[model samples]
Each structure stands twice: as C-alpha cells, then as structure tokens.
Target: MMRSILQVPAEVLSELHATCKLTPYELKLIGELCEILEPFEEATDKCQGDQVVTASYVTACVQGLSHAIAHIRETYKSKFVVTKQSSLGKCLAKFEDMECFQMAATLDPRFKLNS
Candidate 1:
C-alpha cells in the first residue's frame, strides 16, 4: 500500500499530503522497526514452512530477536527513549519471560548443549 501510494503521481501525493505525509523522523523510526523485526519475520517464516522445524529453533529465534531488540534499544535510546515500550519491546517482554523455550532448544539434538 505504501509502495502503491508512493508510485502515484507526485500531484496525487501532494493532494493527499496531509494524510500521507511522513516526516524524516517517522521514516527513520519505520526503518528502525523494519530492521529490528526482520529476524523475527524470517524466524516466523522458517517455523511456518512445510519442512520440519525443530522445537530447538524456538529458543534460537527468540534469543536472536531479543538481541536485535536490545541492539535497537541501545542504539536509539538516546534519541527515542520514550518509545522503548514500542512493538519490539512488547514482543520481547512477552517472550523473554518464557524460560521453557531455552530448555526445549537445549534438548533438541540440533541445538544440543552448545545452544
């Protein structure tokens, strides 16, 4: 939808500028969010695929997302500390509390004790 809107003639964008406009800060935030979520999205896709997905992947994916979120928070906290409770934070909050995922991953041979 955003792509289609952007592809529309400049005149149309100008006409709907009030509703469609995005400030530089907003665009930066959006990019940051996309970067932070990319790993989670890929993990979700892997889990959803027809191929067998070991339960071990759950812990790795969650850890990866946690790291990514932490990186984002650390990198941007100075500028956007107030948005710390954004979607990324919420996701971490929900999953980080679940300790069973780590055990499951550890039990799976694919992950083994190394995980």
Candidate 2:
C-alpha cells in the first residue's frame, strides 16, 4: 500500500490536492505515509546497522518526493493553478523546507541559498 501511494501519479495527485476535495482515503494515505515512512527513508539510508533513526534519512526521502511533486505542479502550473492553499501543499512544503535546510546546512559556511 505504501508503494501504491508512492506510485500515485505526481501530476494527478498534485491536481487533486490543488482543486479537488480530499477523500478520506487520500488524507489517511498521507498521514500513514508520514507516520510510517518519511522520517527514516529520506534522512538516513545508511544505518551501519547501528543508528536507529536519523533526520537526514527522512529529509532525503522527502526532498526527492518534493522535486517530483513540485516538478509535476510546475509543469502544469498554468493549466492547473490552485487559488488557495491545500493541506497537501502544506505537507509538501514541509518536505521542501527540510530539503532546503538540509542543503543549506551541508554547504560551506560562505554559501547562500538562492531562494
């Protein structure tokens, strides 16, 4: 089921999140995803068979998804712009920010974020 959720076409999901109402199933899916997957998959892939959990793993996973979803949204932006924010936007933005922060923190101290 988790894989299925991940399989949801980034385009379709972005559209639904933007304009359509969220069915109970979609809402539950997102909630279950964060609870079950996001924290570990994105931030830390290498456990060394030692560390139980790391924010880095979760962040990495989320960042990957963000790019996919955001790309989908951007590609169809003019065709399907949401007038107001949706719950999914908030959630996706959370991942986006984490990705940004992770990138910022990793670079040399002199580097600055572009946006």
Candidate 3:
C-alpha cells in the first residue's frame, strides 16, 4: 500500500501533495525501516508454534536482531540519515547484556544437551 501510494503519478500527487502523505525522503526512510525490522518479524514468526516452546529463541533472536541492525547501519551508508534518534541502536542496547537470555537458550534441551 505504501509503495503503491508512493508510486502514484506526479500529476496526481501535485494535486494532493498538501494532504496526500509522505515526502520522498519519508517514503525511502520507511522502506529502509522495514528492511531493518525484517529480522525481528521473522523471529516473531518463528516463535509462533504450538508444538514447541520458543524460549530458546530469546538469545538467538537478540543476536539475529543485533546483526541485522549492524548490517543496516553498514549497508545504509549514511549514518546521519539512518541513525538519527535510532530505534535500532536502542534495541541493540537492550540486548547488550542478555546473559539471562543466553542462560535460557543454553538450558533448552533441543539445543544440544539432552541428557
């Protein structure tokens, strides 16, 4: 929907620009934000199973999100553009000392030690 709306012809937007919606920069930023958030989305989907609990995924998910955020930071190039008041940076900070999550992941039987 956002992409389609962003793709509307210039003539249409010219008429409605006052009330229409996002500027080009805003559209691009949202697109980048979605890319940054994709790993978190995937992690959430992975945890939505009935047969098995996803407790072990806590550590894994944090690591995955951290890596994804780092990739976004590097791949996006413009630090000022991508990291201003960065939510991704804040999310990474929350996991910086996730020893509890690591312990939980280590305790899960499916992750190697089953005895």
Candidate 4:
C-alpha cells in the first residue's frame, strides 16, 4: 500500500489514501510532510538520485497524509443534531433525542421511514 501511493499525483494519492486508518500522531506527521512537499509538489525533479525511488518516497509520504485525514474523520464520527423546544413551561419538558444522526441511523422499527 505504501509503495503504491508514491508514483501517483496528489489527486491520485488522495484517492489511494482514502483507505488509510490514522492515529492522531500520524495526522500531525502527514501535515508536516505535506508542508515540506507543498512547494516541490509540482516542481521539476532536480535531484541526482534514482527518479523512480524518489517518486516512490514522495508518494508514500503523501499517502500518509491522506490516511490521516480519513482517520480523523472516522475517529470523529459525523453527528446529526435534532432540536425541538420543550413546552414544559406549558405542560412538560418531555422530548426525545431522535434527531441525532447515530440515533437516526438506527431508527427503531417503530419509526416509519420518511421519504
């Protein structure tokens, strides 16, 4: 997986990177590497070493960044918010937390799917 990422362009790298599961530290490292890669990403290679190997290394590094983004997003599950004002002032503060995304994802059989 690491080797596969290196020969691709940033967009391709991003696509490949979608699968990487990241921890927080990995994310920071990726950001740092990307900062280093920013100016040179589109620059012509002026290095004296093997071009193929260099390309591989760059791709792997970028892949790490992609992995981090995916990881963070997953770690922070997307939330759904539902809100309603309670009329307790008039009757009771009774309500349900049904609007939450996770809750909605598992809406009970009692819930009829809305189009």
lDDT of 4 at 25: 71
Residue 32 Cα positional deviation in candidate 3, in Å, after optimal superposition: 1.5
Clashes of 4: 2
Evaluation by lDDT, superior candidate among 1 and 2: 1
What total of clashing residue pairs does each candidate reach?
Answer: 0, 10, 0, 2
Better of 1 and 3 by TM-score: 3
Question: Mind giving the per-residue lDDT tens digits that candidate 1 earns over 24-58?
Answer: 57556666666555666787875566667545576
Q: Give the TM-score of candidate 4.
A: 0.22
Ranking by TM-score: 3, 1, 2, 4
Report clash pairs, candidate 3.
none
What candidate 3 gets wrong by more than 4 Å, as runs, is 1-18, 46-52, 78-100, 107-110, 113-115
Please give the lDDT score at residue 111 for candidate 4: 35
Q: In candidate 3, what are the lDDT values of residues 1-115, reduced to their tens digit?
A: 5456656775777677475565778877867766656676897886677887776776677667667766767777776436632665576456546777667678887778656
lDDT of 2 by residue, 1-115 (tens): 5666556766677677465755668767565545444433543353223543334344444555545445545534533223212334666457546655466445634435487
| Selected candidate, larger TM-score, 3 vs 4 | 3
Deviation in Å, model 1, residue 56 alpha carbon:
2.3
Model 3 TM-score relative to the real fold: 0.54
TM-score of each: 0.51, 0.27, 0.54, 0.22
Ranking by lDDT: 3, 1, 2, 4
Q: What is the C-alpha lDDT of each candidate?
A: 0.60, 0.49, 0.67, 0.37
Number of residue pairs clashing in candidate 1, backbone atoms closer than 3 angstroms, sequence gap of 3 or more or interchain: 0
Point out the worst 10-residue segment of candidate 3 by lDDT.
80-89
The candidate scoring highest on lDDT is 3
